[model samples]
Target: MNNIITIRFSALLILLVAALVTACKKGDNNALTPDLGTRVAGKYTYSELKTGGKTYPASDTNLKGTITLTRQTPTTVAIQLAIVHKATNEAFADDAAEDVDVVEAASGTIELHYNGDTIAKINGSKISIEGEDDAGTVFTLFATK
Candidate 1:
């Protein structure tokens, strides 16, 4: 009788532990959502700094631009910026796609880097980027879906 009771208690203990672990995993945010790089894949209207430190908005007027992000790999993303001339209604700048590495994705924050440049830091649907132009002028970019 003593041995049977001990065996039943051990089995119940193991079952309780398993149930608690499963419940905790269901509540884990990281396990519930996709990675940051994958979550950030979408179209964004951005504001960029032009040559001579001029700011351009991605509105209908001025030099409208859009940033498209695509997931390249588990830890990499393809970024493309397309800009159009407002007057001529033609493409002004459409550069080749650049690949950026995902640095960190934790606690609802994401950071990406490209050629040692801080390409983007994202929180939720908002993103901020910092880069330097050819003329050594620092530029900041902000975007949203």
Candidate 2:
């Protein structure tokens, strides 16, 4: 019984150390410190938009817009984007984007929900988006903000 108790205590100690190490490694994420607004605030230029085999070009490589992001809590950032209408000819599941809600974590990855409808997943420092655009044209935004 004494031996079993000692073994259990050692196991618990090991587990506790492991947890502490993990927490320390992710300390920055838990800090809830958001990047300076201007550092992450800018328009990213998108190059290609594809649907089927054909690729649609952005009316403007520049996505004129405004985005406000706040670090709601550690590891979570709430972002709102006000995109200007391009008047580009494209159709989508009605709801014609008025705005988009995006949430980006410290992972530097952003998930965009357009007009409270479709969700687009974007990755990388260059901000490459892989998903259908609001106009139903396949869009891969290579722009960086």
Candidate 3:
């Protein structure tokens, strides 16, 4: 009985060590390349978010806001932005992104997604935000940092 218990303990220890070793991995010497840098979160000058190769609305061109993106985990990020509503004349800021998946684009473009749809993409110093409003209007914000 003592020998059987000792053998089981030894096997468990070896298995735990093996699993830990496999979980922790390292890339080459130059794993992190500064060429694809993170976009600085701050007040961004507004531009436009276009789909189907065309602008959505003419009135949304003059919007302004402050956006900040923070990393929550290795693969998850949080985005917060506050913008002034032109029609309502009120500041609308939303930090509703709970656990968004972030992936690095091949050409230094970072794409953000929730569920399965791509919500936004950060390309170089440009940030584009798009979402469907309650009224079914596609709200789009294209800004460059």
What lDDT score is found at residue 35 in candidate 1? Answer: 67
Worst 10 residues of 2 by lDDT: 89-98
Cα-based lDDT for every prediction: 0.71, 0.49, 0.66
Summarize candidate 3's per-residue lDDT along 2-31 as a digit string, tens digits: 999999999999999999999987877565
Residue lDDT tens for model 2, 1-145 = 9999999999999999999988875355734754433234344444444456765555534343433444433323345434444465332222223234555656766665555543544555344444566566665434444
RMSD after Cα superposition, model 3:
13.1
Please provide, for model 1 over 20-73, each residue's C-alpha lDDT reduced to its tens digit, 9 standing for 90 to 100. Answer: 988874466667677656887888776654334666655623666677889887
Clashing residue pairs, backbone N/CA/C < 3 A, model 2 = none
lDDT of 1 at 6: 100
Q: Considering only N, C-alpha and C atoms within 3 Å, which residue pairs clash in candidate 1?
A: none
Report the Cα lDDT for residue 61, model 3.
50
- Provide the clashing-pair count of each candidate structure: 0, 0, 0
Cα shift from native, residue 26, model 3 (Å): 15
Off by over 4 Å in 2: 1-29, 32-40, 54-99, 104-109, 126-142
Cα displacement (angstroms), candidate 1, residue 30, comes to 3.8
For lDDT, the strongest prediction is 1
